[model samples]
Target: MHRFLLKLSSCSLRNSKFQRLILPSLNLFASGSPPPPSANPYSADSFRKSRAFSSKSRALGVRCISSEAGREAIEYDVVIIGAGPAGLSAAIRLKQLCQEKNTDLSVCVVEKGAEVGGHIVSGNVFEPLALDELLPHWRQEQAPIEVAASSDKFWFLTKDRAIPLPSPFDNKGNYVISLSQLVRWLGGKAEELGIEIYPGFSASEVLYDASDKVVGIATKEMGISKDGSKKETFQPGVDIKGRVTLFAEGCRGSLSEKIIKKYKLREEVNAQHQTYALGIKEVWEIDESKHNPGEVVHTLGWPLDPKTYGGSFLYHMNDRQVALGLVVALNYKNPFLNPYEEFQKLKHHPAIKSILEGGTVLQYGARTLNEGGFQV
Candidate 1:
């Protein structure tokens, strides 16, 4: 029954040392191979020409070869910070443009997770409009987009009763999906398009040019002891420089946060601080007879008070599986409020209990969501 929306704000970073440079539109897809600094529009020369950059004495060059710290380096036309949905999609689209124009554009995606989707946690009721635009033949390609959403129900719960309400969620053509599985599939597609995906390699720092523009990122150094001494397996992080760098690391990503702070991205007029919510989710294998694929039930006004902004979701997925979760606003006044305990209590309610009575817990995880409405 909750509305899902993405709000993007335009911002500029103008200071005595840093010039006002507009964030390049995501819609702009460059073609051809990586070019020299003077030939590249995203380079320092062009930044100065556009009056978007000021000189600095960092002594960092355009090309990222081996560093003084003995870290190896690689160059690409585009470098993506995350291998999640946004990062993979961007890499795929860039490669698609390369194919269409018969050009060679090297793209790289760095993921901190052990695998492509290992860290992704979601109560995903997926709408495929973007997928349709990116890959029109996704269904034909046997993508894991099974279990079309068929029914939606909303409930107002009390201590002992479950009252039906007019459902605000209409997921007629959407799909109940495991977001992690889908992300892995998207990773495969990205690889097929020749996008280099480096899993298990966390980006530790954003590499910048002498003009303070982001050139790429440096991966985290591995095999360090607690005392900060190098172990036998010590391997220096690699420097990945690119003509254009994209930070697709979801909301509140480490590197992304650094960039936001460095550029003062949220200093725009009348900006509101970003709010958050903790989403605790679990996948259960329910009894075959009790399973109903594509049945989505949302509940409100039971575990949480009327003043609190939060709800619960129970999505019936394929293979007699059910995915349920509780979202609790992090800004709650009560210091004693425990989201995990609240979720356990939510499962005991008559409405939710009946469905999950004979179910076995398969997997569970928790993650944070951006809840600052129309301010992100």
Candidate 2:
């Protein structure tokens, strides 16, 4: 799914047919600026009215102050939410087009994390094809992509033994990587291409004009108490106006989910229901003698019953570090089943315990993911 998003975003800028298919849904304007009110759904008067007198603004006690008295507004040709691979790729592609055409295009990316890669977590056995297309010289740029996968191992685990299976995992040319590190590297490249990135700013609301066309986003206000009172340090969120707004909030992102429902994005997909999975992952530093830097392992049929649709992955990465994780389908029938506890049980299996008995855990995290590939 990550690869697919990256591929589409990297090529979406100059592809007119693709733009015609997707840009209208995203409310994007052409030629790096919005069209006049006569040709566009948005009007200057309606934009101001929506901002100053919308129901939400009224509920929040936002006054109809003059432009000079309201929160500061920054305008851009494009505004991207989330600094993940997809968003950064789109921003970089737009800037590249600007350089090639000798035209100016303003681009802005907002990330909720304190830093570019702080919120990213994945078991990333990475396929480098997308990266190769996005930046062919990434190898020369010193990207943190090391530890090429050397082999694949798949097993069917019993309580006491691991029976080797005909390995379906074919990671011969992939890499076991820290996805956060790679995303940070991409963020640096985006900045080098003159893209403006604002980390630590969470996009709280999707801004729309009177005609219901998306115009931009509003950042979350700070210094608001849990009881809904403004603190002494209260400050209103800034309004980021853009000709086009891209939401790359990743799997099940809050705003993305809202947008999807609002637009019935999945209604046309033959009524295919979205499925989710809970992924629990851990990184460990193991003894040098026991470490195999490029070995990849995947297992099935233990800890989770046959009825549950789930699996586990263990990848040997660089620096004597091993990344392991368990994915459990959210549709499990057992109401009392805990995914984290199940992961703990998985590590105790004979096949997994041998490698981890003497290791030290470095990091642990869990996140929900889109289960059945990239849908809608």
Candidate 3:
């Protein structure tokens, strides 16, 4: 049963600047708050630190201040990191729990982006398995998904020839979607349920109690200069304390990475060395006749050498829009070869070129893909 969200996170140790740097555009769009003493059930032993981070504290100097001036704490029922699919889903589920049990629980979700869904993006041929459970009325509400997958075409390209790949490229029960839009819609639903969502606030530090159990996280201070000097409008981060804290941050999340080490989240596993990849994508307004809404095309073997693993995807959506992207894995051996450069070269291939011969480019971007297959 579509349970990918049930098991996520735990990425590979090897990541790049594109994946690790703290930036809004870098995160995959994604969504909570706190409760009382009786709700606090976790113990310190639950989150044992590995001495990798001394004193059970993260080196991250980020701290949270109270809603008042005397360094008070803003308590909540739960705290969620990231506004991506997993995080948002968790928030919605918690609200559902509250509704079913007829209780009022404070849930807060902190996102580093300026707005909900602003940071999230994906190639996103979305399968609505989880969404069906989270928001069954999505169809009645008109979520921003319009193009259902109509047909799937796979091609293997040689120097100048285009060869069709075999079966398994199916288009049933999936839709090409703007993941950003989907998150926005989910954010709206969360707000409707009285969930507190604070965008533009990044959880820079994990907060631990006397026994070192993670209680919550600290939001980053604003108005700090690049040189570490406090700007005139300096504002210390607010410490959002909660009974439980969930980190659904995207791949290579610095905070998640730290928590994993502090608690040895992956110590027992003989896995997690990930193969990274760079994805470059663009949205175009293709010719009316060529725009077959729901038609999806994928290509392999031409833009990249056989030794290097990479491929391309093109999905036709509503309004004559076509979203296309290229992925180049990081294990490739050539230092001189650039993923973006290769993606640009891929567009010249006859197979891909014909589709965009007369199309007008509307938008495009690059993102890092951390394919650290999920762990149970």
Candidate 4:
């Protein structure tokens, strides 16, 4: 089943007919009962109108606003904002279509990060379904996707005891991968496809004409002072105009936030509510005796109250390395609770302590994740 899906997914990528592709999602439901009832369909429509009025009322807060002279404008067939998985994949597929159809098209991807993967962090164990569809021969091309999952360990922890539990999670064809490395690899592929990418250029405002229709974006000006004064070396931003502007700026992009409010895009039931999870992770080089490459461990129910939803993952990577992370609901109670401290508590459990005792910390980082569901 895994290989069959991979082959079919690769064919989809090769075709590059994005408009014809049906984006599939997998949703799971509990076994016992059907859902009670869904809210009225137009409930979203009414909610949106109220929210838009409220959003428009709060226009007093503004920071670092600027209208500098000498802005240079560039034209492209397509302007992609962001260099992450979605944006890069879009750029690749667009170029692929141009070549396949024998048409001339100019494409550029504007990235905010100093480099391709400079700001990317993710839980490394990944399903390569999309990767297979985007880069069919990624493995043959020496992409960084290696270290197939070998084992799974699920635990339910208490204050002092660690109990094993049966979990529904499956890892048959998944692999452990560094998202940063994966993104860098994708960036390389994009550059090879002749997609011009400008790093360190943050898209500040969505450019619009008198009609209020988005045409492109303007990059943020550089060399600004702390008091909003232009530095001696201030340079104006670029106005990259395109027929279509695609915003793939992950969860927390400024332009995305503005557009969401301006267009009232999240008025629907599922889209209106969002819950964030704060995950703090560290890579440690454990003793070789404790290293079990491709081993994934997940635990829940301890170091946190039942009301405070949380979990932890310990993925054993290659080279005696273990990536440990703890995720806690951003809406957690206990106002004084510290996210990093909670993760530290997660490590003190006997099950996790054993593997990390003699380990040396390699890297540490934290990121906020949008754990919100989407509805049609």
- Summarize candidate 1's per-residue lDDT along 1-376 as a digit string, tens digits: 1122221111112121111111211111232122344343322222123211112101112233565556667666788988777888888888888789887676778788756777778878888888988899999987877999999999898977889999988888898888777777787788677665666668889999889999888877767899999887566677778889999887788888898789887875446888988888888889999899999888888798777789988888887988899999899988888889989999999888888998898888888888875654
Candidate 3 lands at a TM-score of 0.81
Ranking by lDDT: 2, 1, 4, 3
Q: What is the C-alpha RMSD of each candidate to the true structure, in Å?
A: 12.1, 11.2, 11.1, 16.4
List per-prediction Cα lDDT, in the order shown. Answer: 0.72, 0.73, 0.68, 0.68
Clashes of 2: 0
**Error in Å for residue 188 of model 1:** 1.0
Model 2, 122-229: lDDT tens digits are: 777888888888788998977878889998999998899999989876777888788777777787788667566766678888878888888888777777899999
Number of the candidate with higher lDDT, 2 or 4: 2
CA deviation > 4 Å runs, candidate 2: 1-69, 268-271, 373-376
* lDDT of model 2 at position 116: 72
Candidate 3, poorest ten consecutive residues by summed lDDT: 43-52
TM-score of each: 0.82, 0.82, 0.81, 0.80
Error of 1 at 21 (Å): 36
Q: Write the per-residue lDDT of candidate 3 for residues 1-376, one digit (tens) a residue.
A: 1232211111111223212122222322221012233321121110111111122122222223344434335666788898777787888888898899887666778788766766765667778777888788899987876788888888888867789877466659888877766777777677667565666677888888889999888777666899999877566666777888989887678899898889777766745666677778888888898889998788888779889988888888888888878888888898888888887887788777888989998777776778565554
Give residue 136's error in model 1 in angstroms: 0.6
